[model samples]
Target chain A: MSKPAIAIDMGGTRIKIGIVKDNVILVSASIDADSGNGLRNRLPDIEKIVKDLMNGQKLTPEDIAGLGIASPGIIDTNEKKILSIDKKFGDAPEIDMEEWCQQAFGLSFCIENDARAALLGEWKYGKAKNYDNAVLMTLGTGVGSAAVMEGHLLRGKHFTAGILGGHFIINYKGETCNCGNKGCVETEASTWKLPSIAKEYSSFSDTKIAHVSPIDYELIFKLAGEGDFAAMEIRDQSLQAWAACAINLIHAYDPEILVLTGGIMASSSYIIPYIRQQVENHAWTPWGKVKIEEAEFPASAALYGMAYLVNSVG
Target chain B: MSKPAIAIDMGGTRIKIGIVKDNVILVSASIDADSGNGLRNRLPDIEKIVKDLMNGQKLTPEDIAGLGIASPGIIDTNEKKILSIDKKFGDAPEIDMEEWCQQAFGLSFCIENDARAALLGEWKYGKAKNYDNAVLMTLGTGVGSAAVMEGHLLRGKHFTAGILGGHFIINYKGETCNCGNKGCVETEASTWKLPSIAKEYSSFSDTKIAHVSPIDYELIFKLAGEGDFAAMEIRDQSLQAWAACAINLIHAYDPEILVLTGGIMASSSYIIPYIRQQVENHAWTPWGKVKIEEAEFPASAALYGMAYLVNSVG
Candidate 1:
């Protein structure tokens, strides 16, 4: 019986904190995140939540093996530093996460990019268990990606390799991405771009979904299912953008299995078959078909992943 | 001191053969390749050329350390076999190259994708010498690419990693590529697709280039220099596509140096600055600027590359 580990999965809208052991989440909780305000102010709340979760589970800080965080930005695992800032966590680069964890819980610490952490979780305990070459794409607030090649995680010289899938330019003349690239997949298909993309339809104002505030993929899928013209068009374009992104990933990394995760996958019933068909028609894999599967633990994969990392290091 | 090794670089239209030692080409020759007829029939001609070159240098078969080939298509170096067929080398997969080399010269033989060969050449003796992470893009009849990440060649599960730069889709709604992907950089910019892409312009028939047979990038650059409208449009589109491909490569494999090779780079005076500006404006590299340089040996890098591989393994 190994000691339980504390894991934090930071997202743009919410922060999920969990206590996990042996591939299971013993306890978990989430709080709304005001990402624009930055992560520094949220440390106290995270600490409190972790303590309360541990207490409810009848445990103490001493019972934990280590602490791990899956943050949404470019991370340097060896140096335990955030290399780049995402829109969600603007002040993340300045915070010394290792030191904070040390002073707070007195536990050993490890950190990785949230997408890469999720991949590690899947690679260790989920759908990617048997494959040596795998790619994970998290379709959420922003599209995040991570790849494993020949059983080794592909972290390049700057620690940015295999994590820029959403940033790939799929439409040269399309919209500009926040990352400065033009026509990136994220600029066309992600949640942040959904409203703008939907408004581009001339009939958008006449549609049933037009008045909805904070429109999401789920709503679009529902309206499209109900046969609304604007919704159907938006849904089709988004699907193609995702399919193009998938083909690009397949060509870029040559992974044996591509695992799709994140919130958008809640509509995998419609997304999977469509993307798989497009891949079948377009992807140029001569060796064999790349297996496309949904991640087993879409929401908690990052928690499991961070726990795995912390446990291994501890 | 190492013995001179034989190198063969196979292209769609021509074959470049050379004897190399200490990074110098002792003797070299070229022969037009009727690739449609397959590599099996070309073996006799290649053998004769090798013998003649060696005789002129006063060297016997035993004087050579080994033989290496840089051929177009996906190659499995471990099996010393061609795994996929390219339009250039349609019958390459069926040819037992190692066995043929053994029967012909009683020398150890190795083969690699030509783009990877060129990259190795650049990495060992050319512009990429000091950088541990580097990417090489070869723009010719087709755009080809290979990458070195963290001081290792990125050969993925199917031996196709880092070699699909041209196949990346930059215009998802654009023309279908020979590789079956839609709107690939190659479909928009490569020499093989040049005629079709040019014809898509309404004024193509009225331009000075209308009468030219088998139009190439050089003529387009020359005409564009003279302010020909159709030529200028074609040139600009090609440059942008190449720039997008460059950014894709940088984002995909975080390289310190990007070496641009191939015949199209003959106009590096125009291509380099334009691409540098676009990369500066669009690439998301926060760490620093990625240096872009022309290949030191655009025509003969693969010759040097194969020689290095053969000598090292010999």
Candidate 2:
């Protein structure tokens, strides 16, 4: 039997940690990242969670093969350190993650960008297992993406190639993005930007959505289902933005399959068919239609991917 | 000394044939592609041009190592055949290019997309020679692009990945492209679309561009220099479109250098500075700025690339 590995997925708002073996999570736990407190201050919580999970599983440090971490932002996998944390954990890049793992767990550790880890998880244990060329679009606080081309993960000179699909300019003359680009898909339609985008709609004052605070895709979808014009307009525009993003990924990476993930996919019944129609009508794929599917592992994709990475490196 | 190779660049309107050795062209010839006449009918002319170029160089079939052909379409290089012609050459996909070369010149043959060939040419013998990760954007009748990543030419599953950079949608709610996408960079500002785009400009009737027939970039730039308001508006729009394309390429390919080519670059004094500014201000390159430079070979990049391809394969 293969030994179990400890996996950690560090997101902007939460940290998910698990003990995984043979693609199965034995025990998992989630804690608020409390990122405003910085990652260094949260390191002790992560350690305690990992230890609790191992103890619950009746396993010790020697019983585990290694530790794997997936975090947002540019990661230097070779050094097992975060290179730049956009806004999530400001002090993450300065934290010596590999040294922390060695001293706390007494095991080897590997770290990769969260999006790339999600792609690896999908490739290894999900819908993309059958595909040699595939792309993943994760719609959450921001739009994150990763690609596998001809069976090799596309890591460019700076390890930023496939990870920036969210940043592709879908609207050349539109709003400016925090990434400094104008009219990125993330800027036009993402969870973090959804509230402001909703407020700016021309029909906002006359519709039910105006009364809703903490505007998100869930509320928009619910309101649109009730025939709210402003909500419907915002929903349709968001779908178009995502569909445009899908076509852009198809053109940029030439993938055989596009796997959609993240919190927004809860409405896949409406989102999937709409995006499918748009891509089929707009993408210039000469070979055949690229398969569009919802991602299988939603919450634990990075954890599963971390397990794969740790095992492969070990 | 290396044996000479016959190189052919098949464009929509013309065919350029040359005898090349050691990255240098010995002799060359050109003929109207007369694509409306069909590619099958022009195969004989292509053969004759190759023969004449070989003769002018005092070389025979035995002096050549092989033949390489570059065409503007999706190409199956393994089969040495064009896969899709996209209106440029209606009958090209059905023609047996390998059989023609074998019977007419007694040489082994290879074919690649024109844009990919140009990228290879630039990588082998131009400004990108020193960089392993580079992208080439050729701004002409249409925007054509190709990429090299980690020292390998990126040919995705369907051989369309790197070649479709021009087709990336920069405007989600913009015009529909002939390729089925809406608001592609090619649709927004390529040479073929310039007239229609200029005609729709708000200031068209009030400026000199309205009186110009067969509107091309040269006329627009000349009039813009003379302070034609419509011409200046159109020029700035076109520049923004091209600049957006540069940023899109940077986000997609993650290259160290961006090599610009094609006929529209004749106004590089205006274009280079504008695009460089946009890229520097907007591109999210955490490592460093991606260098933007003009292609070294303009008219004969594909021919030089063909020579390199033939020599490498031989």
Candidate 3:
């Protein structure tokens, strides 16, 4: 039997830590990240929390094989540095995370981008175990994606190749992308950017959505289900954007299956069929239709992926 | 030294034939394809032309190793059938192209999709030489592309893989693609669909482009270069579309190089730089910018690819 491992999922706000030998979680803990203070400044705080959690569970370093950290932004798996993080992780790129963990715990540590980690998780512990060619897309604040091609994570010559799925363009002239390009898919349809997009509609002031102080996809879907015209229009538009992004990935990567997840996936009952039908009608796959569906495990996918990736590395 | 081979590039309008070895065309011939009459009806005419060309040059079956046919549409290279063909070929998928050649001239035969052939051309003998990970995109009546990963064409389980680059969705609802989907890159940008797109632009009637009976990128670029406002707008928009498409390919297939070819490449002087700048500034390649450039030999890349492929099969 394989030994258990420590899995850590670090987000901007909080971190999820757990012990796992297989699919079953032995024990877990959550701690505030306080990411705004910079990684170096918060390193001691994180160490303390992790130490307390391990002691409370009566587990020692010898109990685990290694530690896996799933962080956001671009990861240089070669050097084990975060490298060019988003606004969220100030010292991520500069911080020696793997080395710090090694010195602190006298054990091995590894790092990976969260989306790829999630895909690894799904492939090992969730719905995509049988698929060798697949893509996992997280439609949360921004569209995030990772691809597996011919049983590889498709890291390519540079680690940047398979993970830029959200940056795929849905409209050539739709809206500007955060990466500074105009008309990227993420610009027109994402939770963080959707409210601004909704306001761009001519009837924003007259629409029911204008009355909501803080708008989101959930409210939009609910209002649209109740026949709010503006809400319905935006909802359809967002769906189309997501569907197009999916088809683009299918055409470009030729994946056998596509996994949709993230906070937006909670409403996947409405999103899945719509995307499947659109791809069936529009995507030019002469061989067969790309299978479309929801992700099996959400928050735990990346955590579990860490375990799979670490084991694979060995 | 490698033996010489004959390469034929079959198009709806014309056929380009040549004796090429190691990527250089020693001699060439061109004649109308006349494929509109249907394959069964046009076989004799095409056969005679090919025979006359080879015979006139004193080239014999003993002198040539094999003949590779770069046909338009889905080709099952292994099964040796067209697989999926359009109206131009009429019963092409059912035709025994290989058997016919064997009986007609005692020559070994093979076939590949024209786009994939072009990629093979660039990879083996043209600009993409020595680059194992790359993509060849031909922007013509419809966009066509093929990819090579770790030094091989990505022929998916069904042969549909790595050949649907043009069908990528650029708009979720921006335009209707002829494939029955809303907002495909082909619907919004390909030459076959551009005339109507320009007509719907609202300003077409007032712009100089309206006066041109056949509106195309050539006219658009020509007039735009001459300071025509409407043509300029359409040209910039198309450039942006192509740029977004480039990013889409880069993200989808983690290629180190992207080769742009086809008739539209006549505008590469402008297109390459625009895409390069856009990719440099906008794309999220954490490794570095995905190198973008024009197809080295344009229409000839496919023929070169054909020669190399045949030589390898032998």
The DockQ values of the predictions, listed in order, are 0.82, 0.85, 0.61
- Candidate 2 per-residue lDDT, tens place, A72-147, comes to 8878787777876677799998989889999998999999999899999899899899799999999888999999
Pitting candidate 2 against candidate 3, the one with the higher DockQ is: 2
Q: Quality of candidate 2's docking, in CAPRI categories?
A: high
**Candidate fnat values, all:** 0.78, 0.85, 0.65
The runs of at least 3 residues in candidate 3 whose Cα sits more than 4 Å from the true structure, single-residue gaps closed, are: A56-58, A205-213, B40-42, B56-59, B85-87, B201-213
Model 2, span B1-314: residue lDDT tens: 56788999988778898888756888888899898878999988888878877777788777898999989978888878788766778899888988988999899899999989998989988989989999999999889999999999988999888998889999999999868789999898988899999989887788888887989998989999998888888889889989988998898889999999988989888898899899999988878889999889988888988888888887
lDDT tens readout by residue for model 3, B1-314: 56667777878778787777768886777777777776666566656766776787788888886777888877888987887665666678778888887887787787888988999988887788899899878887777888888887887655766777677777666766666667666776778887987888787788888888778788888999999887887788787777777777777777889999988778878888998998787777767767787888897988888888788886
Shift in Å, residue A295, candidate 2: 0.8
> Poorest 10 consecutive residues of model 3 chain A by lDDT?
A305-314
lDDT of each: 0.90, 0.88, 0.79
Tens digits of per-residue lDDT for model 1 on B68-120?
99988788889998888667668889889999999988989999999999999
Q: Rank all candidate structures by their DockQ, best first, as comma-separated numbers.
A: 2, 1, 3
Q: What local lDDT does model 3 show for residue B296?
A: 80
Worst 10 residues of 1 chain A by lDDT: A83-92
Report RMSD for candidate 3. Answer: 2.5
lDDT of 1 by residue, A1-314 (tens): 56799999998999999999857998899998888999999999999998899889988778898999998878888989998966777898989989999998888899898999999989989999989999998898899899998898777888888889899999988888988899999998999999888888888889987899889999999999999999998889889988888888888899999999988999999999998898888887888899999998998888998998887788
Full-model lDDT, candidate 2 = 0.88
